[model samples]
Target: MRIAVPLPGTMWAFDVISIIQIFDDDSVMYGSSDRPVIDFIANASSKALDHGMSIATTALRDYHEKPDLIIIPGFANPHEIATDRRTRDAKARLFTADPADALAIRDWLVASHREGVEIAAMCTGMFALAWTGLLDGVECTTHLPFLDDLAAQFPKALVQKDRLLTHNAKQRIWTSAGGSICLDLCIALLAEHAGQSLATAEANMLMMHYPRSVATRRSDGAPSVLPRPSRQSDEIIALTRRVREHLSYDWTLTTLAQTSHSSTRSFQRRFSEVMGVPPSTWLLTERLNAAKELLELTDLPMQQIALRTGLRNADSLRKHFSAAFGVSPSRYRQDFLRTELRPTENV
Candidate 1:
């Protein structure tokens, strides 16, 4: 599993290198020391640093072999970084990346992806990935501060502001929310490329619990939070987006197949092929996911929440919610209720 990191401009965070090191170490431990070769390929042979960080790597033109995966690290936001003695000279390179470099890197990524190289972007690195136009119509997320900018700039990209991770299995692109969560994304990518056992070992070594969404936790403690897009035709992807936006709507296999302009049998086969679940199962999962969000973010009554999420009533919602999350709707809401939002008892 050869890994590549592309360097276009400054403000390169350490995510790319950290991920490489972990994978490289695991390969060595598993007696494949020379496997998973790491390469830092750039448009230029050497890019000058802005005083805060430095890296030495080869030029893309000089590297002949294509990598199995490409990981782009988040570029540091200037406002987020304090201007201390080390980084006082660092330039603000967030959205204002060098156009020529960005274009060169974007072109390389587009070409590489066509040849089946999986791409993963961390935090604001998503900005660069978004530049490739592959993220258009694909679900993604970024650092909280830049989520709006990412959506505004790439109007076609489906930005999930609340999602900690998003994967377009069809395109083989993975994106994550910003900050240390990047490490969690790295472990996920690691689990996919390497084995899950190694990924679990690495997470334990790092003393981090694998990042799992409450709605998809497995008993084994492995991560199951990779909310994936349909890995099939555009019709399927479009159908998925529609279902998510209208979770409250009463939907059936017939209705869903008609919406996608396919017959019921064909739609079921295609949807299940890409999503690993039938249309009905997918719809139920989406509804449950929406319910969890409401439980965390709103104080709406259980009946209203159920109605809004297409779960019929409070009893149905409670049954499904507990089955998925191992807790009742009321209990789930209690766990996420803010201190200020909680009702005060009489003194």
Candidate 2:
């Protein structure tokens, strides 16, 4: 399948490459060694940036071969530019007024959809796609910080507040949240086009645990673990301890209630009363917290950690991680490791 990626000044580079790599893998089920081909083209009007940075053109005109997918990567903000006023102003003009890039992308997206092509956006690229009006009435997600802005700007679109990826089958438009979640979306796409095994292999090659579905929520407003009054509350704590001890076990409300010597209704009530959330919600959070600790201190593969933490599988763990931290397991580990190794500033 051919995928077209339009480049705008300040587009985040990693977002573009993550999508490209999945389709480029020749060993995958969807890929063919003989005819495995994926194409990327930068659709920008001028190849030269006024700031002295040069961008190459894969195609001079926007109309080339129709791509099966078109992508727009997130852009750098105005505040991030350190160049002179002229360069900054030029960038602003290019982005706001130069409809060449946007129009070309819009035409390709509309045409591709008419011919059964898929259009996707990563991070803030959702803004550009939303501008095309194709995402109207479609469910989509963008970077969390921009959720409010995207909703307000495009009231016609259904903006999902807490999702790693959201899609509207009607529009065939897919959007993903933040940077690392872009990789998750690509893996999911690979799974759909190829098969579960190929997706798992691709994830293993990248050292990424397969990502979870985007519907998971990080918070259920649970209470802290400190002591609370009452005999029932203490029993709830004991049940929590048992849950933690056997995280790999399939825990059900009846199982927990039986272990705690309480009815399901009583267990649910007391657990929620003491923890400020349902028992199941508390258990999931505990598992996720334990997984985070293991990720921080140990170099265990995500699948092992998931098994140890009682998550259903690696994909489920990634879903929780993405929802809780907005990053994949590997990226979170690297980031934590970097912070841990950083030299301490003298206080």
Candidate 3:
């Protein structure tokens, strides 16, 4: 697989380097025996650093050999970096005065997509993907802080704030939250090309526990809780934790209310008010979360996973998974498993 990485001034160095290392390690551990050769190109118009001391890349020409995959790393601060005059001037010479580097990267992205090349962005790199119009009508994610901005910037894009990664099949765009998660995303791609064992080995070499499948959602509909700010808040949080701990068993709101020694109605209202969701909603979300983890990390079948997660059957599990995420439980597993197979393929 041919991979292109276009660096830009102010680019987060670690994002690009980590991806390169992940692919390299995969090749040594898995490809040395049977995988395809993974070709990489650090394509750029000129090598420079932005004021923020981030590395910048040169532009990729239209006639340049198209890569099988392209990765765009995040910048130190995408908002400020995008507005830098030198960065704008350099990109303009490559792309068209004051042309946004995001647009330049988008052109190559679109071209690569047309050729069936996979395109991925890490962290705030989703910002650039959004600018390209390629992510229009596609589900994608970025750093949590930018979720609202991303939605506002590209209304057509389904910005999933509560996800570590999101893939838009219709547009062939994949995005993941920035920072160390980029390593997880790259490992996922390697897994898709190779196999799960190889992906796990590579992750182990990096001292990382292979992430739960990339298909896992950040929100399983659980209430987002803040640390208890006072004694009353702490008591509520303690109750919430207890409920979460018992998710795999049959527990009811009345049961929880009784435990907390409050009237059921008052307890329900208090739980909703403190946790930002009702107790039942929170319990179901916790169960679904447990199910999701098992689905991604284990080879267990749907029936077993459902039973272990406290769901009655596969049908019940699917209802919750589909309602929480737009995809079925089985489909999520397949998507995640496919990524694991990448590094094992004849690279």
Candidate 4:
């Protein structure tokens, strides 16, 4: 595969260089001759980019016929970086990028996309992609801060805030929540070209887990408390999946124990040994975690949340939620939760 990166005048330097390095380093780790070739292209060679630097690029001479994939890199946020006026001398041009440059990039991207070049965009780089009208009716994501803007700017495009990456093979477009997560997009592209094992090995070499496979509407991606086993106990794993799938089930200690093929007393003892907490404690924690997730990701009424979490009612959930989080559900959602388009008011 030949991937072309269009270095527009407003493109972020880090987004360009880091994505290049990720592919290069992982290709080395992949240790294969059939690796994808990445090309850095420019609208014109030896031009200054708006993010305080200049670059020279040439590989894709004619946008309509050259590359298999095209990457649009995110640039510095003109509004945010301009706050410290005295120190941001190099990036001042970002505040007033030429209208012609913007329109030219959009037109070229639209043409290239029409010619069957798969496109990947990072963060605000999506604006150029969206401007071509190709993102209409397509699901996409960008930086969390730009989620609202992307939605507002392109009303026909679906904006997903919680998702780290989105790919629509039909449109040949891929968008990602930007920043370092751009590398996650790189790894995913690597996995697509190579295989999951190469992706897994590349991720392990980077000392990071593969970001996500199928994304849920979640913002809670905290690190695992337990070290991941290379091979998990199938019984425990399947049991855990079942419990989560039906968290509202009225689970008695005896019923859960029987699922593990042990007496209640023996199960409790082994469960405590394995999880470092009593089984009862684990149940409560899981229920509360479910409740908290509902609070963050949805505006579901309190009684509905309680039912899904197995707390059975608003009264039961409030009692446990207050003790564990030290705040009301409304307040927690207000403080931490951001919806795909807007934050929820008290529900």
Candidate 5:
């Protein structure tokens, strides 16, 4: 079965292209696996759109021939933007606005649905799908921050926010959560056609781990590791959870041992044996992870990041961040922003 992805105006270049690359770059999949090819189509500026992006594709001679699946990639919907009243207001409007691009897309998608195509929308793209009126009287979801907006705008639709992915079997439509869930959506899609084996292999290749399905509550509040042998170490798990909750607090070995209700020697041995790392090393790694996430996901200053991750100061943030990522925090943020899909006022 074939798939189609429409490149509408204001589309996040990264969101659209990541899905494209997943299917188009079969070389990344297993050597013997069968993968379906996806078509990318757009109406205007065949060569260009938001973020100065373009793709090469052959114009389909027919619109009546709907592909088996239509994957609507997400658009960038940043929580913050430059601090100008007009720009901020415009950015706000464009995020939820039903622009001409979305209206046109709605019309086309409604028709494709009649042809029995399974439709999937990622992140804010769900807003466009909702505009089609097809989501009315159906259970759906979108980015966590915009769940209220989606519900208010489409009162007829049952918008459930807790889910990372929502699939209406009757409608054959799938909606995935925002940001990184695109990877989750892609992995699930590939698993649908290819087998779990191929999807797992692709996840490993991409440095991502696939969930059981879109419906499963992911145990991904933190980075994951091999499963513990039994639930007896629930106390240690509880202690670790507390550490994440209070990452910035000054934590010492004595305090950690007391928290775990064990002697310093016993606590260090148990933590190392059960969690695969000593408490000190694990704490350092967690701090480094927190700093890295802040750098990649936010525009927060180094001092703020240091304070948040318990690094204590900007210098420490730089020293540890650079050691872990091989780049300073500013350089790392610049490299991330270059590829990140910041929603466009026009898109």
Candidate 6:
């Protein structure tokens, strides 16, 4: 059977690939293995992990054939987690590397799933799969630290917050929680094709338990390793979430501080601590991001797009978009349109 793995934001992606490779060889599985064929895919530009490693990846759009299974690995967002452990916005962070790139990957995943490919996500990679709408009304789980955020962001998903691993048998989707438990997910997937005995033996040889053990949850339902954020930090996170959801609102530092129930000074200090950006700067960045998505996905006029993103006018949108992307809005949209019309056309 053929398997596809998308090169994700985390170095754990490599770990997942390594496990698959170990089971892929003839010596290991011999007569019992499915003899899996693996492919590493990414968007046009290869993704660089936060840990300073990069891999050569086949562009998913250029890969014509669908594999029997697709595995999405956890995304690395250590900085965000470190700042506010309890409020790690999984969906927002999914767009951190590049919104267009993330959307392309999500679109490909949606199309591939519709074609009958079994999809699995390791740890917080469930955020990527959730963005594809495959997890709606289906049982799923992610890294414990991200459980609350994942549920808040994707409410339709039946998120088993305490489950180390869970599967939707009908849809052929699987999810495993954080840490080395992702290794267990790979073995579980193997059992679907290979016999249980072979899978059990492989787990034994690897010194991992065959079946998932009950994951202990704290009384407060928080990940023990990630201490809850301070009340001030939670307030700031809530304010930021509101800002993201309502980009069309006219937001100012004073108004933002009011929303979070803090003074201007305290609000600025805490917001910077949690988000690593001053309120105004973060607002501009988010507004421009909304504008970028609008440019790519809609046929609205520049003025309308600017208004929708709270940029006031086309000229303002052009200035900020050109400054940020090194191209005017129209040019960027033109390039996107051409790419859409000729998907296989290489840049």
The number of the candidate with the highest lDDT is 6
Q: Which portions of model 5 show Cα errors greater than 4 Å?
A: 30-33, 45-50, 57-64, 77-104, 218-347
Q: Tens-digit lDDT track for model 3 on 49-131?
A: 33434343434553366566777777566665334344323433332223554465556677778878878888877766666
Q: Which stretches in model 6 have alpha-carbon errors above 4 Å?
A: 8-14, 25-27, 30-33, 78-96, 213-347
Q: 1-347, model 1: which lDDT tens digit per residue?
A: 67888766564456765666577665344553223567877756654444565777787668777787898877665233222222211222333355555555677899999999999888777877876788988988887777877787678999987676777767898888766667777777765555444555676677553233312212222234533553455567677777767888888999998887779999888776555456676677668767866765678999999999999999999999887655688976665444225453321
Model 5: ten consecutive residues of lowest lDDT:
80-89
lDDT of 2 by residue, 92-187 (tens): 344434646556656656667789878778887776677667778888888777887778767898988866687555566778886677887887
Error of 6 at 91 (Å): 5.3
Give me the displacement of residue 209 in model 3, in angstroms: 1.9
Comparing 1 and 4 on TM-score, the stronger one: 4
Give the range where candidate 6 is weakest over 10 consecutive residues by summed lDDT: 213-222
RMSD of 6: 20.8
Task: Give lDDT tens digits, candidate 6, residues 112-169.
Answer: 8889998988876777788788999998888877888778777899998657777665
Alpha-carbon TM-score of each model against the true structure: 0.55, 0.56, 0.56, 0.56, 0.55, 0.55
lDDT for model 3, on a 0 to 1 scale? 0.65
Candidate 1, superposed: residue stretches over 4 Å from native: 26-30, 33-35, 48-51, 77-98, 213-347
Clashing pairs in 6: none
Runs in model 2 with CA error above 4 Å?
25-36, 44-57, 60-63, 78-97, 218-347
Superior by lDDT: candidate 5 or candidate 6:
6
Global CA lDDT of candidate 6, please? 0.69
After best superposition, candidate 4 residue 18: deviation in angstroms? 2.7
| Residue 331 alpha-carbon offset, candidate 2, angstroms | 36
